[model samples]
Target: MRFLRQSMIGVFLAAVSLGLLVYAAYVVQSAVQARLSDDAPAPPPRERVFAVHLERAEARTITPVMETFGEISSRRTLELRAAVAGRVTALHENFEDAGRVTQGEVLVRIDPSEMQAAVDRLSADLADAEAEIRDARRARDLAGAEQTAAEHQVSLREKAYNRQLDLAGRGVGSTAAVETAELQAAAARATVLARRQDVARAEARVDQAATRLLRQRIALTEARRTLADTAIEAPFSGTLSDTSVVEGRLVSANERLADLIDPNDLEVSFQVSTAQYARLLNPEGGLIDTRVLARLDVAGVDAQATGSLSRVSAGAGDGQTGRRVFARLTHASGFRPGDFVTLEIEEQPLPDVISLPASALGSDSTVLVNGEDNRLEVLAVTLLRRQGDQVLVRGEGLEGRDVVTTRTPLLGPGVSIRVLRQEAVVSAGVPDMLELSEERRARLVAFVKGTEHMPAETKERVLAQLAEREVPAQMVARIESRMGG
Candidate 1:
């Protein structure tokens, strides 16, 4: 009975200890939940402010420019062709591609031996004809002299017949003598008529010789002309291209030898949309002489020229949507045919217009302008022209106000903005020179040297820059951009 009572006491003590532990765990859980619910903070409100680039709108007269790509061409181009079939005997010292030639300069010489021989033969024939003409003239003179002698004999016979008739009439001569005198006069007259016919025949022979002489002279002149054609002379001062003829090369008549292009007389041919084409014309429906600047970027080198709008194509080309236009280049010294160039044509100036970055203009010609209290205001603008990265716009209440240069979807009317000033605009100064490594400098130098299409002057300038210890940052960036770096 004592052992059973001790067991009961131990069990009761174990149960009480278990209940106390469970109650302490429940109180700790409640205290932790209450602390959490009391310490958690509320969520903050969302901010509507956005950071953007901004530029002040200044209204002024802006001249819009239309940019287009074009190919350089020569207004005067000639195909040098052979006029006679012969072997090329001689070539000028500068008779090669890109060779400079003056007007009337003999560019190539064909074998003139054959043509010379023909000319000599024709000349000999002409001489022979001339000699024959002289001989015929002498013969004609001799025939005339014989006719004169025969006429004298006829006159003498007639006088004798008259005398015989008178003697017979006076009874101092016999009738037979008078009749014989009359017969003699008749025979003399027949001899005179034969001499006259001989003179006529001789004259006809002389005329025939003269005609033959004329024909022979004509033949000689033609042969001489052909001989002259053997020496191909430059029609005008130009540069030679597409040269195919060389010394000892046999060529046929009318074979193309080379192409001659007047480098000074160069033009740019480009195509523009119908609307742009219409804007390039004057009120008279003719192409306006708008000033144009053409630029060719060759291997990071820029070659520029100035010109004026010349004409428009007479007919639209097949598979082309726009009108073709041509500009007459005034100074095209470094330009060549087939060079693709960019042209910036000056259009009519717009009055009271604001020029801004293209990114500033939004859909439906709306722009975001910073309004009162630095809030964004959607302002409608009239987009006059889009030139490169800039747009010319005219709108009321835009002047003397700061307009956001860059737009984003998050930005809207009445939204607050934090202006991020652009260093490129705030400074508006020359770009700083950049320090380059030896490898980069060498690479640029090699690139400039390898650019065969670049103009010599531009290449030299670029090389000079590369030789310097530091190059302009902007220039380096431009070069790298062209190099696709």
Candidate 2:
């Protein structure tokens, strides 16, 4: 009976323990499901991050670069116009289409037969006039001789009349003799008057002949000049750009023969805004005579020419407010007028600026800078200028700091970045110990500063930094000076 009671008691205890164990398992399962439901929903899919290369902004002496587009034109241009109406007879060796020519060089000869004939006719007329003048002179000389002879006859007749009078008075002369002497004297006087009239008439004829000869001589000169005009000549040295006439072809008076361009007198014409003009036009601006260099690219020809600044328009063009300027070329060969060309001009430069590839700049005129927390931070940069593929920028904290050079569309503000960068020393005496981790560099820089008053600490930092890589003595001194001892 005692053994039976013990067995029963053991069975009861086993059942109780089995029941408690089942309850505890149910409770534990319920708690686990509740805990999982309450846990913060799995953090949203993490944003994608990109690795990039970084470079430190550099201190540079950047030149002010000006970029413009303009047209090429010749300073010396000429239009070949005919001087008179004539048929084209002969063309000079250099008178072909687009031929080259020099000043005072004949280009073509017109049909000068007509002009030559006119010249000959005028010459003959002048000869006739001169012969008439000579005859009039001879006639006048004969008239004068006759007048002198008539005067001598009159004197002789007077002497005879006086002698006849004395004879009559002495009663030895007859009345008939005295009367005859008087009559003779009177006839002689009348003859002298007639001779004088002839002389006057001859003088008048000579004068008239001289006037006619002078007029004929003038006509001869005009005819010769007209003949000379038959031969065409180049006004200045240049290449014949467009020629419309050919040898053995006839041309009209005042007709355009060709267009000439002086390659040696090439110039580049360009327009600029009013603000830009102010800088270039200031009397003290010093850009008036500044040398302007130009480059020309000829179409369909593998040739180029360089030029210099020659002149600026005195005033803006009518209805065009901008200033126009020109540059003279030294090597104008192989260049034609009215060609378009690109240009680069220099302007005033800003000091202490940084230049980088324009691609790195963002739309808002900002650039990505590596931040303190190893993240990207957008910083606003002031743009000084933009050239072809290059830009000059100025920012508050970009100096001596690493910046992302290339545009990274995937990288945004507050995003973490793993910059894979190489150590490159900046040229302008800026220390490039940036190879060290940001934290490590800051700590080392601080340590170097703290050692200024403590000779032992100074030596320690100097030796440690020197062991890794060389540090500039100037930087060490600067740190020591900044130490708040």
Best by lDDT: 1
Query: Model 2: residues >4 Å from true position, as ranges?
Result: 1-36, 40-61, 102-104, 127-217, 282-287, 291-303, 314-321, 348-352, 359-382, 393-485
- For model 1, the local distance difference test gives 0.89
In candidate 1 the C-alpha lDDT for residue 278 amounts to 84
- Per-residue lDDT of 309 in model 1: 87
10-103: candidate 2 lDDT, tens digit per residue: 9999999999999999999999999988968787798666787787788777767566778878887888887778788887687765577889
User: Please, what are the lDDT tens digits per residue for candidate 1 over residues 1-485?
Assistant: 89999999999999999999999999999999999889568789886778898888889998889989999999999998999999998999999999999999999999999999999999999999999999999989999999999999999999999999999889999999999999999999999999999899889989999999999999999999999999999989999999997799999999999999999899999999999998888889998767999998666556789999888898779999779999999877578899999899998777899989999999879999888888989889999899889899988899977888888888889999888855335565766899999988887777778777777778888888878887888778777776777
Candidate 1 residue-wise lDDT at 13: 97
Off by over 4 Å in 1: 1-59, 93-105, 141-203, 236-239, 262-264, 360-362, 366-381, 395-431, 435-443, 450-453, 467-470, 478-485
Q: What's model 2's lDDT at 441?
A: 51
